[model samples]
Target: MKTKRGKIPGFAIQEMMVVLAITAIVVGMAFSVLNLVQRQMGSIEDIYEVKLEANKLRQSLWIDFNRYSYVNFDERKGQLYFSNELEEKNYTIIEDMIFTEKDTFNVQLEHKAFYFKNHEKKIGEIDAIELKTSKESGHQQIFVFKDNAPATYINHKP
Candidate 1:
């Protein structure tokens, strides 16, 4: 090779090709990492959604359990009826979802049980509930209990 005294040297064809190949490899690796990160983020988002919904369901049930003077479970209908002097609320479990009077909870239940005074009951008045969410939702167990019941409610039958 020959060059004038004042001229700058250019990259050889082999060196240019090597640099381009290295850049392409780096870019490909970067894209692969990005794709992997995106997939992991998607899975995390799904788990977060499930946990959020489960928390919402727990909070709602706690509130209703405390507010109602009487609680009754209908095994045949897969329903829980909560009633006070002025209002009534119904929670119906169907398939993978729970439907209340005003809202629906998209929670998949793996197990559910109703209890009163530590004894499990299938039908009629109950004071406590235990439920387990599906494995995909982290297998969360939720228990709601109402410790106090009015004398009238305790004496009466529903």
Candidate 2:
């Protein structure tokens, strides 16, 4: 008696097409996920840059606002000039870049302005002063200074 050998099986064209289609689907899904992650990372980076720059501006301004005897702003020059009895310094913006006397950073600020409130309606009786930014208006809230303050408005410079 002789024993019969089993035949080697091979995949048909339809079976091969099915495998290829499945592979394509998996690879396509992977690529889509990768692309989404990259986009998210870029967005996160942009937001972080904006925040970092804004913080720098706020910190520098806080110091200047406290120390200076006077404060002023120049819209065309994009400068916040601060002054004392002896010296004058400034924080200027150029080409979306902010520059202090010693440090500089890039930001997306669109506007600079000063607001004064005169509830008493008397000459040299300004009760409040506000330094505002356009892009992130929350950076500077309305600051109420004391009445009869010697810090008189002098053309937007401090």
| Top-scoring candidate (lDDT) | 1
Candidate-wise lDDT, in order: 0.90, 0.60
TM-score, one value per model: 0.90, 0.58
| Candidate 2 lDDT tens digits, 15-63 | 9999999999999999999999999999888777767766666666666
**In each prediction, how many residue pairs overlap at the backbone (N, C-alpha, C within less than 3 A)?**
0, 9
lDDT of 1 by residue, 72-131 (tens): 999999999999999999999976999997899899999999987778999988889999
Backbone clash pairs for candidate 1 read none
Best by TM-score: 1
Q: Which ten residues in a row have the lowest lDDT in candidate 1?
A: 149-158
Model 2 whole-model lDDT (C-alpha atoms) = 0.60
